[model samples]
Target chain A: MGELVVDELEVQKYQEQEVEENGLPLVLLYGPLSLLNVFGSESLLNNFRLIKPWESPEIPLHEYLITHAKNVKALVCLGKTELDSKAIHCLPSLEIVVTCAAGLNHIDLIECRRRGIMVCNAGNAYTIDGADYAVGLLLDVLRRVTSGDRYVRSRMWPLKGEYRLGSKLRGKRVGIVGLGSIGSEVVKRLVPFGCKISYNSRKKKPGVPYPYYSSVYDLAVNNDVLVLLCSLSEETFHCIDKDVLTALGKDGVIINIGRGPLVDEEQLVRFLVNGDIAGAGLDVFEDEPAVPRELMELDNVVLSPHKAVFTPESFIELQELIVGNLQAFFSKKPLLSLYKNALSASS
Target chain B: MGELVVDELEVQKYQEQEVEENGLPLVLLYGPLSLLNVFGSESLLNNFRLIKPWESPEIPLHEYLITHAKNVKALVCLGKTELDSKAIHCLPSLEIVVTCAAGLNHIDLIECRRRGIMVCNAGNAYTIDGADYAVGLLLDVLRRVTSGDRYVRSRMWPLKGEYRLGSKLRGKRVGIVGLGSIGSEVVKRLVPFGCKISYNSRKKKPGVPYPYYSSVYDLAVNNDVLVLLCSLSEETFHCIDKDVLTALGKDGVIINIGRGPLVDEEQLVRFLVNGDIAGAGLDVFEDEPAVPRELMELDNVVLSPHKAVFTPESFIELQELIVGNLQAFFSKKPLLSLYKNALSASS
Candidate 1:
């Protein structure tokens, strides 16, 4: 193995030789895309044989998974890959799944729980970065940061006289839709900006100083800006619908750093067009990489391509956490970001 | 005055009759534009006779000022109008100059002090708004909020795939220049975002927890982001010069919400062009209504047309302060936003 040379020839040869070469346990890289290329996945290469099925586009993913299932004891998934029951069934020897993202909606927790497979996510590693992004989006929308940039870039300021004034962020009533890690972080950040913060979570939190509304509609009714940072669950899906948007009213804005399905895109577009809602700063869409064309043209709204949780700093942190979880799982000590609630349920 | 009916007819009539009609003390409204329309300047109209030179464009400004200079006890000046020594000479009877802005650099404080003419600026009225804007601009630049918005708007996201990753705001070293009200406000705002904040003010602030650098160059050298929120003066003009920008390095961003001359705009443009500095968010420029055309093409820079202090909420606060200052001057009370150092120096 001569220090495991990562040459192109060796990389190609390893694809044909799918066994646990050089006494390294196999860790299947499930998807074609991963941020592992960032640090070159050096940490993983040192400890395990990584079989990336998606690297060979000619091979069917299921066929590739089955071929290496006997030796594959772990799997690492990226953003877009689906790890459902069928895929889980393919990797029968897999004992742990590491998702390199804050959200685990793409992973089937029920299937993992039934099979006693521990799942670890990039946990609080992204909390501060995600919260920072949400605040940035809110400020951009309310202060017209992006639109002002466009106006300046278009050589329109000298021609257009003055750009329109945007609403102030300070002292605006802000309702955070969820009070989880990211949402809590948003509250902490907004407090110093002088925003009147309130929130709506699934259940009342005991010690939170913020006034809690029982429902999202009530939260919207009372606040000027509704920040959607809640997880997308069966019960939380499409949480920000026409009714919530209507309650938010004409001068209100929505900032969605949560899943796209949390907001009803059709209703949101209609509201923005008719001036029923003032503006929105959206980082996600129902179908990613495909934003509504209507949103693109609107000067009031700011659009980002689902990049809320990504930053070089956060990516570096995530890579560390992912490696830590993998090492912990292989050593059987404990997974660092293990979804412990599901683990407890199955135990 | 027939109950001082504020009709369209009377508004036109007031332009023709610029004297202290109905025994109201005259307040000369300098320049053509004012945000007076926002709240209708009811506060001013209720207390004083308003004289606007630019209202009747046919009447030359010099001619108009000469006509009403005797009774122009207070002059309300907006952005474009230069209330220089000549303007002070024009308004011979001027007792107080109420500038509708936070910065008093526009007014000749020296001349005003020598002449026993008290000056009142927007004061802390713009403190929070300016700070909010500074934060918005910093976030926009660092997180690529404005550029991301541009990418989405230009219909390039689908073609370009993922936009370039932006530097994270959290845990980065941020240095604020000028620890005045706006600067202090920025410090307060940035603290919660997990930044290690430092500042370079004229002197060390009493009991400030953050480390203090005595010079702008040192502050720039030590920080990842430099926020310009200080007053522009002879001592501080072009404070952020080529050396400061270079010390800030390739990943550092500069956010300017203070007066434009506070930073060397030409050097800033050069640094941004060459990627010597990562980015900048500028709200003010050395020349008003004239930005470097070179800057219009850069994605790394976000330009705002001196709009940091223009929100309706802030404007309303400013109007109240202006009216209060005028009334205070007439009543021989302390001016609301008096440039007190000059007052104390001259008293």
Candidate 2:
């Protein structure tokens, strides 16, 4: 019996040696399919064992972590994934956490710090792309491009009545709620349209071309169109509420490409129905994928999925940046580190 | 009978005297509802007798002209209303033919010249608006912006399996087939995208920034995208045929804001299906309102009813230009014309 036990112990030691020799450190990837396609190609993922738990609908979070947790050294997560203190505690070997996207509200940064786990995110990767898309949506909605196309395709030649008339962007006052990278890019695009740009951020930046306003109500009142580009945080939740919408006045358009929580959805629907606000172009929603039926019925609103940065160029850039971060972390470098500063500064 | 005729003539003279005192000439208008809105408003027609043949699908050219022809000094017409030599010949007192939109192919220019009839069109009125829409279509088609919106709205969240990736317009080679008013306007807007502009007009204007190509095939072969901005005359009909599509290569996109007959519909359909051409954004069609059913299924193509310049700014500008033309024609002043020079130069 003693000899048999010795043999079993020898076999266990051999298996451990094999795993150490050939197995790679863990990387948990979450997000959409594009996230995987962008970063998990064999050539890019050769240095790590990339595990994507969200790829299948049936894979429960606890089951996934329990099965793969012992070997996980790093995790790459998305906005929807639940990565709280409890989830972090399950992964005994997790040394770092990286996000494939810019937003970090999903991950508990304080918990990660408490556990001495490093965290990094892809910031400014989608700024220009998102800004470009927001402007595109604004123009699409105001100009009624999609509706016009539908009218024409229906064999209605030379649209008349209200359908024939569409507002132009030229010379309209555009209010941007945030003057960060995306908002600044939007300003750049709108400049050529000859629009007057007004912005309301937490504080004013020097030497910017647009006029800055401290109060959201003042910004909404003066501007013909309001663009929400601020980040979603505790302070900014429901920042553009009923009072701000009311201050926007009649014949005002509100475009939200930021977070859905930035604007009160119920108030937005009410304002739209009551004709207090002229129209809206929304790319993000409160519940997402389950957009309100009320918004869908309105002809005035233009809706897009939360896909502002899904352009090929932006996607490629995001992939490269995420991969670079991973490689840097493995090399014991700073990991393009931008957590505490961005949080504090943005907050 | 002679006394009755004399009395009728006296009554007609009395009406003419009253009309002249009112200081408005008779204005005959035709075409779609939007055109009527722009050119045939109540205020515009208040001074003049506005004659519309809505009851009769076809304008009764001779009878209508004979009845109201004598005092109808200015005639406002649009495309799809036949204004042939017979019609022009009958309107003996007609001094001007002012079209509310661009494209004068339907007008009998030779007859107008022989009869010394002054002709003016709403030149450059729709240029900026049309160019803006074309660019919008290009960006929208390439980015799959509308498709993305549709997918999300239809409850297809977290889309999987090879989504259509969009290319950026920045730094792409854009070939303008004709550098006329609309083409030039398109170039101005496209400049900000950092696209390299090339052109192939009948004759190259001096000091233009873009390189000129003498042959359409050459332009198609070299360009990443070819935009048809030339007119559709007999000489330029089917100019961008199968050979041109072949030369454009498989990856090139074609945008035609010009005439649809400039492209061979059969060849275009074939190319679009077989992936000989990447995609197309068409505002005009071979037959308006009867778009090819097959083209509708292709995700690559974007179709708009022939409304490239249906903006409020252009609408107001068109009205003002038409009104100015009427004012100038009544004063017997030289018409602010383009065709006399363009035709001669092309010949």
Candidate 3:
């Protein structure tokens, strides 16, 4: 159940071996196993015959999809490739779209809805890891854990004598940018540390005990730390702007585990460099692999290379969620992780 | 109340201005303010006329205490100075000893008992910070937060591609040594992360839910991570030696927020270098400020400059505990942080 390839080689192997004997319906895999080559631990590779099409030297991706994947009822979308209208139109027989990610920014949900393609995502798979990484990054930045490690490794402790003291995490007001599942998990974890949590979401959540601010700037004004866990949309992109950073004040720290575009990278760098803000712990950047040179030089900021949710455990969970949702769709039973909004639109 | 100099200069100023004005009682302070120059935030420095002594070219510390500090009724012991029999003997008129630390290893408890002197320490002041740091170190070590920070800072993400995945911290069996206030707090913090907790203390604690192992070796064999938080005593010196390290196996992690020498530094260094243990997050070392040359080269270990409990909030709490206990003693009231065993012996 763990074979991973949205490419020619695995497809060739699967088609040759079990297509006729198993009589399993074919589903198209979207992309190759990208990061760490981890496609899915939960993929029942033998249960389904897999085929993929790419913009190739011989034939274009649209032609390949129409000719090779025409009868493919399920299309799996990995985060790498954009599943836009062009790609969706090529898969005319596609009934369900399964994505192994919590965020659906990569796939055009509206297009999928117009085609009546039921969409499901990895539900709660990365929530704990995302929350854990956010809290870990915040604690690391506040306590200077990474900086202290570097200082010790540089043999500065013997030369510099006493290191600087870290501020206490307890009693610090932490404002969460998104009060979704990841944000809620972060709140649960921070509760034990005695931190005061407030959140900013699209709307004021009913049952949430903490105060909610409709605007991100107001949330920044009252909190010592701002944790970004919300999705990246046109409206939400650069949500943490110069004004919000200013409102957060000089004692403010930012922990970004969500998409990098959630914070205005240029203004954030300016604030960080000029000491407008205290520090930051960023796992994501505006550009995926490219980080600002100024941030690289600063000791106050901790730079993580977008591997916050690369835990083997979470990947396993994602594999299960993806495979289970696909099976549920085929069985005509209730899909496990069907996008709630997608259901409302379909109805 | 916030003046921190423990040298002759503060003594002279206090003796002239405060001793006569308010008729404040005198107490001898130990050591200069070390590590972030944070002496105490809660210290009612004006509440008592402070005096201090040290062996210098001018006079020996014992001679300075006996001659210049004979009438002093109270002595304050900072962590830097060892309060052995010789130093304790120098304070002849001392009725009470107040220390701004949780550990009593630096002080001679037997001597304090023989002299009928009351000893109190900074109670629960550093507890939250210590626990927070221990958990922080654990999360950092397991998740490779500091190393990832280093990777991104070194500008290796583009060149090297995606960074290696860190093992999940959840579901890892963690064993704590010295399951007192700090260890208990650590357990509380780890609960939400879904980690399994176990411990090795001097004796099994009653009403505690976690499984207890009497020996460190047994604990190491049963757990994936071993956290050292026990007090360093003759019996516990080098408790986590080669055998324990071997038992912990190749994938084991160690988090030390307690005193150094709890784990054999030489053996630990060898194990770390040889890959006998997975990783370590060390805040304390066998020698203060002097880390091993070998440890400096490893990315698996996170080295802190022994400032885990140096947060200003805790420092303030330490100050308050020290002053509160002293005030309680002079007024014939209960000391805030009296050593429990001392009280037991006294009764």
Candidate 4:
């Protein structure tokens, strides 16, 4: 009674039997478990046993899944991990796959549906954070805040001549592409700067206070600063190309917080070099973790490592939301689901 | 009209003669005049002869007085330039000396009186511009906007773990060391951030909405951010010492836009290194044009050259105001002067 102990193997066997009888779910955490600093909460962790890939470094994905497949129910993963049919076949008991990110192109929705699995993504998770970053980038680039800092850091005091002259953001015109969650949030923060806000979306958002442009080129032409906040789809791919950049004119600044593929990188470099655009602030890149040296050479651009939603506060919030979604799904309650049409019809 | 070919020097001489005979008595231009892009504006030019050092770089002070002294009633200058008995004696025709800056430290008021010359300094020229730069510096420092920019430019993508976490200015307590012209302006700008404002001045102004702290130490203790907007003089020099910095505590961030000499540089460096103070945004340093390399090594500080009021708009406004003050002095009308106390007593 004072120090009661149970056989470890017997306890493990009993737990496995209970899981097999109740259809226990498997959740594979593929990326850094330091994300636990983000997603770890007593209520959130109680729902599932997290399988961290880092802890089991040598274990191959197929072998691990096959070994643990009997009672597996779901897989929670990140961008770096690929989920395909061959890998999916190993997890015979897998039912649901959740991606804690907005983009779905990485996940094979058709293949998931064929395997009778539900796919859900975390959409608008980066909306506010991304928007804030875009605004921050805009301010940093236009004001030459970073260049001034670098100058001082290099022990080059008395930054004389044109270096001292930084552009003021007050009363400047800001054009946003795609008035989605992130785009609208960008407008909210920028309103304080007294910028005249205009935007180009697929269609106008009615009852919204800001002016809307019918065409992306028209928005670029009229705005002093053009912000890329649109979604990256077939129609919107490379929408902000040479012609759109030309429309932005010589003194105009362009900020891209959307996907890298949304912009024509070659054309952007050309425009920035030739003074077709005054400057740019980019968070997303084409083939990221591999930023172009050409962009680095230009002092006019402010680049971020696509870290719009990587704040500590945002990470915590994202984790809480993901946990809430999982809990609701398990409890047979309506989940805070994204891409409902795609999920219901196919995946 | 085609036959009337005039000599450039002759035309300049005639123009100078006309100005000496009928134009304004004083022209106090504190800032650089090249900022006024529209040089051909005859109306603006006809208002007053420029007292800018850049325009007449080769002309000695003695030569300037000798050439224009015959009909010149007064002269104009800035606080950076010294106005001693020698300057007064050389400009024998100068009845008044107007300074196009807030401080009168450079102008020898006692000597001006002995020489029977009137002195006036522009007290409000720096108010709004100083406030703008202070807020800009605060935002720049707190958000690590400049550091982020540098990271991006260096082609370094900040992965989740590598990202530098920046603090938000909202809801933070800010202590203003002096509630004077620039300090009051700083308060007005900081109001929108929803920050709690407290201040310490030699004496409190009537109807100051913010809470007043009697002592700098007390203010530093209570506030998360401390902004030095006090005037640099004997009593206030090196006011923010080791003791005050210690009082400011570990979480406090200091922003000094007022003066370099106001902060004890060595003590500040020590505090910064030991994390006694979180960070600083310095627009002025103890030895300007020679900022310490040690300060440059730290990422927690943002340094700018002494350029708080160096905007093109502010420069233009200051020039126009100075010219107006000069015009008033030459007409023998009661000057819209800064030193009315001394002037009335002298008269």
What TM-score does chain B get in every candidate? 0.92, 0.87, 0.93, 0.81
How much lDDT does each candidate structure score?
0.82, 0.72, 0.83, 0.69
Which candidate's lDDT is highest? 3
- Candidate 4 per-residue lDDT, tens place, B1-347, comes to 01213334533543444254343333433334443341122333566654443446588756665565544556666436666666566566667776665766567676777667777666575676677667767766776666666676665563422447566555789999998878877776676555699999987768998888888888998899999988787878998999999999988899998888999999999999888898998878898777877888887888776666555555565666666666777676776655754454443
Q: Model 2 misses residue B194 by how many Å?
A: 4.0
lDDT of 3 by residue, B1-347 (tens): 13444555554566522132466777777775442147652245568766645423387778877777877778888765688999888778888988877888888888888888888977789889998888889889888999998888888898887777778887899999999998998999999988999999999999999999999999999999999999888989999899999999999998998888898999999999999999999999999788999998898999999988778788877877788887888789988888876545643
**Pairs with steric clashes in candidate 1:** none
**Over 4 Å off in model 3, which ranges?**
A1-11, A15-21, A33-36, A41-44, A54-60, B1-11, B15-22, B33-36, B41-44, B54-57, B343-347
Q: Is candidate 1 or candidate 2 better by lDDT?
A: 1
Docking tier of model 2: it is acceptable
Residue-by-residue lDDT tens digits, candidate 2, B1-347: 00112233432433322135455666666554344644435445545555544424465747656665566677888544667898887778777788865777778877887777767877887777677777777766666666655555555564442245567666679999989888887787677665799999998879897899998999998898988888778877999998999999888898888888989988999999999988888878898666787776776787776767667677677777777777666676666653463234222
Per-residue C-alpha lDDT of model 2 across residues A164-223, encoded as one tens digit per residue: 446777778999998888888788777766679999999988988678899888999899
Residue ranges of candidate 4 with Cα displaced over 4 Å: A1-26, A37-47, A57-59, A66-71, A79-131, A158-162, A332-347, B1-45, B50-74, B82-132, B155-161, B169-171, B177-211, B324-347
What digit string (tens of lDDT, one per residue) describes model 4 on residues A174-261?
9999998878777876775568999999999998888899998899888999888886778888988899989888889988888898
User: Between 3 and 4, whose TM-score is larger?
Assistant: 3
With a 3 Å backbone cut-off (N, CA, C), the pairs that clash in candidate 4 are: A26-A73
Question: In each prediction, how many residue pairs overlap at the backbone (N, C-alpha, C within less than 3 A)?
Answer: 0, 0, 3, 1
Q: Give me the displacement of residue B329 in model 1, in angstroms.
A: 1.8
- DockQ score, prediction 1: 0.56
